[model samples]
Target chain A: MLLEWILGFVFLIVKLTIVLIILLTVAAYLVWVERKLLGRIQARYGPNRAGEFGLLQPLADLVKLITKEDTVPQEANKGIFLLAPGVVGLMALLIFAVVPFGSGVTLWGRSIPLVITDLNVGLLFILALSSISVYGIALGGWASNSKYSLLGGIRGAAQMISYEVPMGLSLVPVVMLARSFSLVEITNAQSARPFIFVQPVSFILFLIAALAEIKRIPFDLPEAENELGAGYHTEYSGMRFGLFFLGEYITMIILGSLIAVFFLGGWHGPLLPPIIWFLLKVGIIVFTLIWFRATFPRIRYDQLMNTGWKVLIPIALLNIVVTGALVLGTS
Target chain B: MGTIKNLAEGITALLKGLATTLKILSRKPVTEQYPEYRRPLPARSRAVIVLTRDPDGEERCVACYLCSAVCPVSCISMQSAEREDGRRYPRWFRINFARCIYCGLCEEACPTLAIQLTPNFETSGRDILKLVYEKEDLLVNHGGKNNEYNFYKRAGVAMVGDKGTQINEDKPVDLKSNLP
Candidate 1:
């Protein structure tokens, strides 16, 4: 029993190391991918100088960020400003803890699950961590002691709060359909068919809310570069700025994974290995996000609020009721 | 019913926008990758300024300071001196290329056809002082552009040869021959 526990501990360490490395690497490369794809969409080549197709750009960017001078405003709250970036990065990483990438695989006559932890309320864990991530933005903005950053922080806090409700409500139909909050069980439920086919309204609502939640373009009023001069991170420089970007990209990947697990039938495709299917789904979702960025113009702040509260929340509530009634009648 | 129609139309507009971008994404990018492929510039395309020699391999500049005067950025400076042969030349010509706007005004203002613009605009330097080209850096062996037109040969100046011996000049009528 002691030997078994030691082996399990070792495996856990290995898994943690692997996940961290992969997540960080993917987050870095996603920046490159987004640039290249957006460039192509706009009829240009982006960052092709560093390496073959600018593969080394992320490394170059990392070096540049590290070498840059990290400035702290004289009048700013130094402690919170310094800690804010870490909160965002840490919260993003924490959310992935409950996200199952694949089913358990038997190795060395032992069954190993491909997640850090399978929390019973995995969905709630994701929501809570995402909520906590807003503090990173809000605090980073407020601590900067600049009006632009303050405005950005307030906007980020308000937008995130407004969108969080619709985002959570949209997931209700999925939770009801799966009848379990554990991501692993949710995946198992969708072994027959992905939830996207049955609950497309939920999928659309979730997609929109998730896009707003992530502060992507068309809903990126928080960091509206033209108006806010880099928004909440106006005063952030060097590695701190890099940390914020790292957090954003990691959350993008996390959202992709969550969507895959919740709606796209997590890693259950025939012929291909489970992990590959999961990756492919995430890639598609990430590509769509980039495409949306390239296509859509940023909506007005009033339009954004109107769409969120008056439209999305009401639709999500109605969707929940209809889905609940259907589930009851079918059962 | 009206709200539903409006919603449908709004979504359609978004879908149309997405389609347009998707279509462009499928097409080839229009970027011309520099360094690997240099576009051919026209002969008259103003860029790096050069001092050209006369066809006889003589410096064409009379050091008249016309280019220096017309230079908008005041980048050109030179000390004028008369050679032992009575030909004029710049003793220590300089151009602060870092200050040059490539306006071609100096080229247009050049009376001796010595200063001309070339298409070779790839000049870059790590140090600011490196961009300040001296006479040696600007001087070229060949008579650039109008190679046959020597300033000294056509100027009717007595320096290159006697005034009557210059090209396109009328012979001096002698008073002694007119005595008949």
Candidate 2:
């Protein structure tokens, strides 16, 4: 029993270390990807001087963020203000625990699940954790005691909640097809047949809804620079602001991975190993997200909400119903 | 009937919107990668002004200061002096291109056909002083294609003679005779 406990602790540490490395690297590259892709779209050269093709630009940004002085508002809620970004960053990192990087392999004389935990209700767990990220935004805005931040927070909360319905509904067909809340099972089912082929409409709804959830362009109402002056995390500075920035990109990576696993047959391909296939799929999805960001303009708040509640929600419901009927009829 | 028609119209509109997006997605991007592909400037493009000489390589300017006077940006500065042969000439001509708006008005106002706009528009410089074109830098050996036709010779402006030698005036119009 003692040996088992020690082994578990070691495994936990290993998983945590892996998650940390992946999150930091993904977040850093996301900045590079955004600049390079946006530059191409705008007919301008993005950062190409920091390192070879500006690969080290993110590192330079991190150094700048670190060296800068941490500023705090005199009238701000010091406790909540300090804790907000930490909450966001931690929540973003935690969501990666259940993300199956590859199938189980025998390690140290035991079969390991590759994932940190393969909980039966993994999907629900992810949803719950993702929902908790909203608190960080809300808390940041409220603690700042700034009107713009307050408005941003209120808008972010409403937007997130409104989109979550369609986002959740979009996943219903996948769950129905896989017949399990377990991410591993869903991935396994996807190997047999990618869900995108069967549920293209649901995939589209999920992409749009997920983009909204992550507050990307066309749905980036929370931090509308022109409208809200940096939005919920406006007053945040130094490492605190960096943490929020980190959280945002990490969320993008996680969503990209989720999309890959759910619809694009995660880790399933010929010749290349499973991990490589998974990375390739995630990379493609992330590129598509960045492409959309560069190409499209931000939607207005009312329009965003209308699209979510009125348009997406109905379509997602219809998709689920149709998927259900098709599955039943086929079976 | 109206509700059903509205629904059909909405569906058609949505499909049309989707089709447009798909068309754009399939088409090649319209972006022109500049620096690699330079665009051709139009014939009448007013990029920069240059001073021109006659075919005989004589300076066409008579130091009239018309270009300087008409310059909107006040970029042109020149001093006029009479030569030993009693011919007007510019002693020093300078144009601070940094301040010049390249409006082509100076070219239009040069009565002597000395100034003309050129096609060379890429004039960016690291230093402001480098942009200031002196007389030597602005002067060109050939009269620009259109300015080859001398305005002074064609307009009956006498250069060396009194009123009787002026062209097209019929010996000062014989003002005492009023001939039919």
lDDT of each: 0.94, 0.85
Candidate 1 ranges with C-alpha deviation above 4 Å? A1-3, A71-77, A144-151, A234-237, A328-331, B53-115, B146-180
lDDT agreement of model 2 with the native: 0.85
lDDT of 2 by residue, A1-331 (tens): 9999998899889877876887798789898888876675555567777899899999999998999999988899999999999999989888887888787778879887778888788888888888898889888988999988888888888888888889899999999999999999999998878999988998989999989998998799999999999999999888899999999989989998899889988788889988888889989888877776765678888899888989999999999889899889989
lDDT of 2 at A207: 90
First chain TM-score in every candidate?
0.99, 0.96
TM-score of 2: 0.67
Residue A297 in model 1: lDDT: 93
Q: Model 1 over residues A1-331: C-alpha lDDT tens digits?
A: 9998998899999999999999999999999999999999999998899999999999999999999999999899999999999999999999999989888799988889988999999999999999999999999999999999999999999999999999999999999999999999999999999999999999999999999999999899989999999899999999999999999999899989999999999988999999999999999999999999999999999999999999999999999999999999999
TM-score of chain B of each: 0.85, 0.72
Which residue runs of candidate 2 sit more than 4 Å off their true CA positions? B1-180
- Expressed as tens digits, the lDDT of each residue in B50-123 for candidate 1 is 99998889988889999999998999999999999999999989999999999999989998889999999999
